[model samples]
Target chain A: MSAFYSVLKRELRSYFASPLAYIILVVFQVISARFFFLYLQGFLQFQLDPSYQLQTGDLNLNNLVILPYFGTISIVLLLIVPLITMRLIADEKKNYTAELLFTSPIHIRTIVLGKFAAALILLIMMLLLSSVNVFVLMVHGNPDLGAVLSGYTGLFLLGASFLSIGIFASSLTDNQLIAAVISFGVLLVLWLVGALSDAESSILGYLSVINHYEDFGKGIVDLKDVVYYVSLIFLGLFLTYSALESERWR
Target chain B: MVYVHNLTKRYGNLTAVENLSFQLERGDVLGFLGPNGAGKTTTMRIITGYMPPTKGTVHIEGVDIFDEPLQAKRVIGYLPENPPLYNDMTVMEYLSFVADIKKVGRKEKKSRIFYVMERCGIAEVRRRIIGHLSKGYRQRVGIAQALVNNPSVLILDEPTIGLDPRQIIEIRELIKSLSGDRTVILSTHILPEVTMICSKVIIINHGKIVLEESLQKLSEDMRSAESILLRTRQNGEGVVEKIHALGNVSSVKPGAAGEYIIVPRKGAEVREELSRLAVENDWGLLELRPVTNTLEEVFLKVISSEGN
Candidate 1:
């Protein structure tokens, strides 16, 4: 546990030591804020429109602004989370610092979990900063607090899943750029799978990462969706462990 | 404190280390000498638990490294050919991180980090970023990182490979000071480094140990192979035949500039006889001195002899 903490602390410090973390945070905030305003303007126009009054039940704030806002951020996270996790293990391998960690009295699991946690923490920070858009609704307008909280939870799960696979990709290579590309490619396919499958009950559709996240955006935290994300997190970390262990033999 | 037996590491068709075996007692400084790509680094990596061998086992303090790697690794500190360092971290931060992973007790962590920093001569630059430091200082930080846990078995591979003369001397001195009651394995191809710092020497070539002997015994063996150089101003014909005919001389070979290198038979005193023969043959001997073999010749002889 101490070993895990040390690696986690070092990884977090490394993220902040460069301009990369600040740049990522600033960019995410700008993009998410822009999407929020676009959705808000569209929501207000629909509420004032006479033809839209017949669909008023379906034109609530959750559908008009919050759900779409969280949806855009989820896709944005697909691009950004890779940037956060690309260097976690790849940088260590490139600089040969992996040798130090490999020779130390620590399990491979500890190293993998430490890096995963650090990236998760940074993603959560990004989510909190963007929550200012929801906070604005809370102060000036009446927004459903439960739905807002559940939307945030959905975004966290989606981002966390991306991070785990990012770490797995990072473990496959020493080049950070290649790591980033590999994770982005994997995530793009997974996201496209939701559209590729026509039925929600199909295997491909059920396996889609974004498919499970849809329920959470509707303010529903199903046990099934939680299990899916947790399973993905475990699979990614397990593959990373296997990759690292195989390297020692080579 | 460390025992390696029948270790072999094969990467597909290529074998890096083959049937290698050796042991180290407490406080023994074993110098691992080899040419480039001679598997010195591979052996050190295996010993430090960074990798496993394809065959055989390494026991550190009676713990099998393959079976209980963490237990074995807890007693080892390794500095590979390239010092593994986080370029962006401060010297203090790097050491603290290493100490933590090495499982240094909380109460001793601060003192141990300070002690290693001071011991490795990096105390002045503890807060400095490792990437901004010079190669010498970075190497010092690498050593300090290894020393943070006060490991019982410290393995250094080419520690002074790229340092300037002064820095090399300082690192050698630092390593010498740190050798008290600790088992150290210093690997390098430089012969003087072995003579200066190692109590026992092991020379490896082509993934096999060519020679392993105590420094004292090696020097003694070098001294016992007596050879004399006889350089003359006047080139005398038939001098080689005359020397071969001389009962005390075993073999005589022509050296550079008309000099003859004469090897004497065991327990023979041929210097007096050779001087008398020189006068009788009217060869103006300009120089006559015993040829002492340096470690270089011994190493070359061992390597070349193994080739044949």
Candidate 2:
């Protein structure tokens, strides 16, 4: 466990030592803030009463108020998580530092998990910063804490899954750009799978990330959705570990 | 002690190392001599448990490296051909991280980092970011990370590659000073370094051990057939013929400036006889010095023979 933490700390330090973490945070915050103000302007122009409670309008005023915020947060995270993870293993391999980690007494799983944990911590920090938009919504009107917490929960899981996928992709090559491109491509496919599938082809829909995320966005915590996201994270992380292990043989 | 038995590593159809086997005793500095792409790095990687051999076994302190890699790896420290460094990190941070990965106790980690830094002469650069340091200091930090855990065996692959002459000497001296207490296996194409620091030299060629012998025995067994440079005032006068007639002298040829080079049969030293011949001929002998074979020559001979 200490070994895991040490690797985690080293990875976090690496992130902060470069311009990457700060860049990702600033870009994400700026985009989320922009999206929030745009949504606020639309809300004000529509003259939606702050006291207008939605029992079920065509667009629930409450959903209108929070859904764009969730959308903005998700889009920003989808782009940023890959950037954070693109260099995790690819740069290490390029620098030949993977040999140091592999030869050490630490297990391969710990090294992969540690790097993922570090990236997850950073993603969570960004998610928290994005939540300031939610707090802004709260000041203007009543925002459902339960719905917001569920939304944040979904964002965390989605970011973690993207991070694991990025790590797996990074493990495949020494070129960070290739890793980023491949990770983004994979995430995009997973995100759009549901949109491409109909209810008759719902099995494939389960593979879509948005299918699971929708439940969280709608303030519903389904055990199956949690299991799916957890499995996705594990699957990506497992592939990454296996990829790293095979490098020695190569 | 370390033992390797018929260690072979193959990538698909390409064999990087083939049927290689050698042993090292405690406190022995074994120099791995080979040209580029001669499997020196592959062998070291396998021995250090960074990679498993496709067809053989490596035992570090009797623990099979592939079977119990954690335990086996705990006994060995490896510095790959390129020093594995996180460039963003400071020397102290890198060493501390290595210590953590190597499972050094927290209480002892600081002291271990300090000790290795002092040993590698990078104590003053501990706070500098590794990327900002000079190549020599970066190499020292690499060595420091390898030595942080104080493992029983140290495996360094091209530890002095790319360093300036002064840095090379410093690293060589540091490696030499590490000899008495731990087993060290260093690989290099620099033959003179082997002669200088290694008690035993294992010359590899084309992924095979061409020569594995103690430095003393290798030099003794491959000693140049005795040859002496003889400078005398008496120009010719059949001096070459007269020297060749001596029992131990096999041949003699005229050299530059009224000098003759006398060659003796194997294990024969004809300097004394040649001196007597020159003195009896009333020739003023200017010089009589034996020509010895250097490690470079021996290395070339061994490697060239393998090429054939």
Candidate 3:
């Protein structure tokens, strides 16, 4: 436990020491805030236009401003998660510090978990920082609190899954660019896999992480969706552990 | 405290180490001597449980390294050719992390880190980032990290490479001061450090152990009466005949600078006899010295002899 904590602490410090972390935060805030403002503007225009509103009067602010905001941020996270984690293990290998971590008594699982946890914590912080948009929704209009809460929950889980993929990719190489590219490719596949599934019972739809994330965008926290994200996170981390172990053997 | 048997490592068709075996007891500071690409680093990594050998067994104390790596690694502190430092971390934080991973208890962690820092002479830079420190200071921090967890065995591979002479001496002295009941294995291609610090030496070339001998015995064997140089003021009368007549002198030839290059018999004390012969004949004895073989020559001889 102490080993896990120490590695976690060091990893977080490294993230803060580099400008990349701050840059990612600013990027996320700017993009998500832009989407939120656009949705709010569209909602106001919808209310003012009698013809446009008579056609579709069922539009709500929670759906208009908050749900799409969370959904858009999740897509942005697909890009940001890779940048955040591309160097976690890959840089360690490049710098030869993996030798230190490997030779230490800490288990490979602990090392992987420490790095993943640290990155996930940063991702969570970035997600929370964008809640200013949510508070803005709260100040001006009545928003669905349950939907907002579930949306944040889904965003955290989705980010965890993306981070796991990044962690696995980082373990496969010593180059950060390759890790980032590989992670983005994997996440894009996960995001697009649902389109090929035309049936509700199809395994492809069940496996599509983006599919599970949609319920959270609708303010519904299904136990199955939570379980899917948790299991995917586990599988990704397990693959990372195996990747590190195989590297030692090679 | 360390035993390796028939260790072999093969990377596809290339064999990095082959059938190499050695053992060290408590307080024995063994020097692992080898040239570049002699598999020193591979062997060290295997013993440290960072990599597995193709065929071998390494026992630390009594535990097999491959079978019980975590348990074995708990007792070994390894410093590779390049120190594995987190550049963003201060020395104090790095050492603390090392201590934690090495399983030092919370109650003992602070004192243990402090003791290692003081011993390694890195206490003053404990608060500075490792990347910002001088190379020598970073190397000392590397040693400090190895010592932080109070492991029973220490493995330092080429610890003094790329240091100024003054820093090398300081590190050498530091390593010497560290010797006690703890086992230390320091590897280097440089020969002088072996003679200066190690009690036992293992010379490996081409993935094989060419020689393994104590420093005293090797030094003694290296200092035999094979060749000598002599010079005298009176070079003419009866001097050559009298010196030649000595049973120890096999052949004598005039060398440059009015000196004699004398070869000795199988086992002889030519220095004492030649000095006496010069004095008895009133030939001024300007210089009498044995020409010992250099370590480079010895390594060449050993490798060639093994090759043939």
**Model 1 interface CAPRI class:** medium
Name the candidate, 1 or 3, with the larger lDDT value: 1
Which one wins on lDDT?
Answer: 1
Tens-place lDDT digits, model 1, residues B1-308: 88999999999999999999999998899999878888999999999988889998899888998899998899888898789999889999989999999999999999999998888889999999999999988888888888888889999988998888998999999888888888999998778988899899998888999999999998887777869999998567899999888888888989777699999987688999899889888888888998878889988988899889
Residue runs of model 3 more than 4 Å from their true location after superposition: A51-57, A196-204, B233-241, B250-254, B263-267, B279-284
Candidate 3: C-alpha RMSD to true structure equals 2.2
lDDT digits (tens) for residues B232-300 of candidate 3: 774666666777888767888876655888888867777887888778777678998888876667777
TM-score of each: 0.94, 0.95, 0.94
Per-residue C-alpha lDDT of model 1 across residues A171-237, encoded as one tens digit per residue: 9999999999999999999889889879999999998999999889888999999999989888888
Write down the RMSD of all candidates, one decimal each.
2.5, 2.1, 2.2
Question: How does each model score on lDDT?
Answer: 0.90, 0.87, 0.88
Give the best candidate by TM-score.
Answer: 2
Task: Give the DockQ (C-alpha) for candidate 2.
Answer: 0.77
lDDT of 3 by residue, A1-250 (tens): 3889988988999998878889899999999999889988998997788776566544888877787788899989998999999999999998788888889988999999999989989988898899988987788789889988889999999999999989999999999999999999999999889899898679998889899999998889999999999999998999999998877777
Worst 10 residues of 2 chain A by lDDT: A52-61
Model 2 alpha-carbon miss at residue A95, Å? 0.7
